[model samples]
Target: MTQPFLSIRKLRKAFGAFTAVHDVTLDIPRGEFLTFLGPSGSGKSTTLYAIAGFQDPSSGNVLLEGKSLLAVPSHKRNIGMVFQRYTLFPHLSVAENVAFPLRVRRRPEAEVKRKVADMLGLVRLESFAERLPGALSGGQQQRVALARALAYDPPILLMDEPLSALDKKLREEIQAEIRRIHRETGVTILYVTHDQEEALHLSDRIALFRDGRIEQTGTGEDLYLRPATDFVAGFIGNSNFLAAEHLETKDGASTIRLADGSLISGINANGAFSSGQKTRLMIRPEAFRLERGPTSAELAVEIVDVAFYGERRRIVARTAAGQEIDIRPTSAAMASQEATPRHRRVFFDPGAAFLFPA
Candidate 1:
């Protein structure tokens, strides 16, 4: 196995009495785009800062290719960073901004100019080289910022919510650009963002953080389809959590009795849980199907709201137990179904539900 490019072991950071990050550990392979995803104040930004040497961790070590990064100065770390806000000098043109890092490193003038031009071309802003930051559009200014970060040819790139300030459409455009840049440069990237969709779209793997600790780390599909904990299941996507009590296990299947006395048979609960323990069964919005079949477990529900979302209709329904669940149905399916039924029935496959020990 190839050695990982970056390895964090028992990393921690604190502010006096407050712990910002606690016992965090991760290994990032070379050229991987890893994202730290969480809500605000979840320590994603703090972890990025620590990696960039802007903030020192209260405990643990950060290693780059097996070497300790403790003694290395921020500039000497050779890591590029892009902040949420565009941090370009007002007086400098786009080309000059991109050339700043190379010049600071005392590279020859000819090489600096060549590298700056190439970097500008990489961002598709070569024509805007002479334009000042104030004169450029928000997207253009951010492109300049990206070019500047690449100026030093850093092996690792760290982004802290760099697209959060941009409008949604522009954020998506830049997100694609960032992915392209990562591919072309083969530079390991550590991105921090609160948007789950953004993380899902761009990252090769995601580290979901919560209250200064990493709750789970996996590919987007892994986290979404098979969340390890209730927090992870709730945070990644929409889920209807049905309170259940473990009834019995036969072979590799476990039976759970829901609050309404419905028996749900699913794969065995692999985690630590005793018989008769209270748990929650996680079912995604799309897991349920509208069908008339004797084999399916039926739920009597009333359609409370309907929302059209182009490709699908968002149907909100209340079960007999008064638990609300959202279902995404295809437009064609919604159109074909009866609209006047006061009480509707829905069925879900047993394999689609996940049992979480409460």
Candidate 2:
């Protein structure tokens, strides 16, 4: 097998007695976009800092194309970084911000000018080149910061919650720019963010962190559609988990008894389960259908409320067992008048359901 482009081999860090990052091992191919996703203090930022040479790992190593980067200083590592803050020099113009790195390396004057222009254009900030960062809006300043980070043509770029400061719409706008820049430049990116939507939108794969350790590493679909653990199911998207008791397993599917005494078979089981073991059945909110299918399981729920949001409708429902759950169905499929406060049978394919330990 070919060697990986970037490798984090059991990388770990500690702050005094408390460990911030557990041993994290991930192999990233060249030009691949990977995000470290988790809540605050879950070690995502700490791991990124290790790769950027800001914090030294207590054990293990970070290797780029088989060369250890553990001993390299932050500035000498030649890696680019964009932080939550813009981190642009207020005194410098947008063009100068992109030129600073080139100037530090003493690149020829002509080369610096050309590279600055290219980077600014790459981020679509060429029109604001002469403006200082203080004059630009938050989103524009971030674009300037992105341009500056990419100006030096670094092989790896590290971004730590770069869009966290922006509003939802602005975050989405810059996310598109970031994706476009990645495709255009083929730069390897290791981005850190707690936003699941951001990770799903930008990453080729994701490393989900929890309590200083990596919970799982896979493509967003893998975590969303076939989560390996209960935590993963809860974190990736909106899911309704009903309490159940495992009855039997065969051919990769399991039979479970729900709290309402409903027998649901053919549910996907994540791990080994003993008979009568308590577990939870996870079904995505979008998986529920108002109409029944041949292979679908039925749930009796009373519609508590339904709110329409453009193409989809958010439903608040209560199961027979008194569990309140969320169901989001497309507006085109569910009529607002039919979704009044009345008892209804919701259908979901058992094959699409997951069973996890309670």
Candidate 3:
């Protein structure tokens, strides 16, 4: 097996008495896009800063291809970093900004020229090369930053919420550009962001950070469909957790009775559950079926509100116990069913629901 190109082992950080990161470890293979996703002040950025040499880790090691990067200065670490704010020199033109790294290294002038042109072209900013940073748009400025970061052809690239400052449309445009660059260059990338949609859309794998620690690390689907903890389920995607009472377990699945006294069996569970234990059932909004199907569990809910989305319809419902549940059924299904469900039975496969202790 090919060894990881970058390995983070037992990384930690602290400020005064407050610990910002705790024993965070991750292995990133060459050319893979890994994202550190979490809420604000959740230690994702702290971990990235450690890898970029912006801060010395309080403990543990950061290795690149078996070599430790500790004690190396940020500039000498040979890592590329694009920050939350575009740190471009306002006076420099796009091409010059892209060439800054090569110029710093004192490469031959001709080689530097060629690299600058290549970097601009890689970011699709060839036409904007002569424009100064002050004249460019937010997206364009960030593209220049990306070009500058990659001008050195570093083995790995680090992005710290590079698109956070842009508007929604511009953020998506740059996200597409970033994905294209990753595919074309195949440089390993470690990105940090609080945007769950961005992580799901861009990363090959994501390390979800909570307070001072990693909650889970896996593909978007892994974290979404089979979360290891309630935090993972709640963080990765939209999940509805309804209070339930555990009934029994058989084989790998367990049974639970919901707050409305509806019984659901064959539900997936993270750990063992005992009879009469208070628990919660996690069901994704998209998992509900408008019409009952095979091996389905039913819930009695009163439709509180409905809204149409492009692909699915958003339904706000209240259970018999007054617990709110969000359900998303495809538009076609909603159109075919009753126009307005005053109070109805919604069905979902028990296999798709997860049980966690309350």
Model 1 Cα lDDT, one tens digit per residue, 1-358: 8767899889999999999998899999999999999999999999999999999999999999999897899989999989999999989999999999998899999999999989999999989999999999888888899899988889889999999989999999999999999999999999999999999999999999999999999999989987888888888888888878988767656788878787777644647667899998888887778775555566778989888999888889997778888888777777878563867888877766778887
Q: What lDDT is obtained when candidate 3 is compared to the true structure? A: 0.92
Model 3 ranges off by over 4 Å: none
Candidate 1 lands at a TM-score of 0.96
| Cα lDDT for residue 62, candidate 3 | 97
Structure candidate 2, residue pairs in collision: none
Q: For candidate 3, write residues 1-358 as lDDT tens digits.
A: 8767899999999898999998898899999999999999999999999989988988999999989999788989999999999899888888888988998899999999899989988888899988999998889999999999999999999999999999999999999999999999999999999999999999999999999799999999999999988999998879999999999988879988877677788999888888999988999999999888988889999999999898999999999999999999999899887567598999999988998888
lDDT of 1: 0.88
Q: Among all windows of ten consecutive residues in candidate 1, which has the lowest summed lDDT?
A: 265-274
lDDT of 2 by residue, 47-141 (tens): 99899988889998999999999888888889989999989999999999999999999999999999999998888888999998999999999
| Residue ranges of candidate 2 with Cα displaced over 4 Å | 336-341
CA lDDT, candidate 1, residue 47: 90
**Per-candidate local distance difference test:** 0.88, 0.93, 0.92
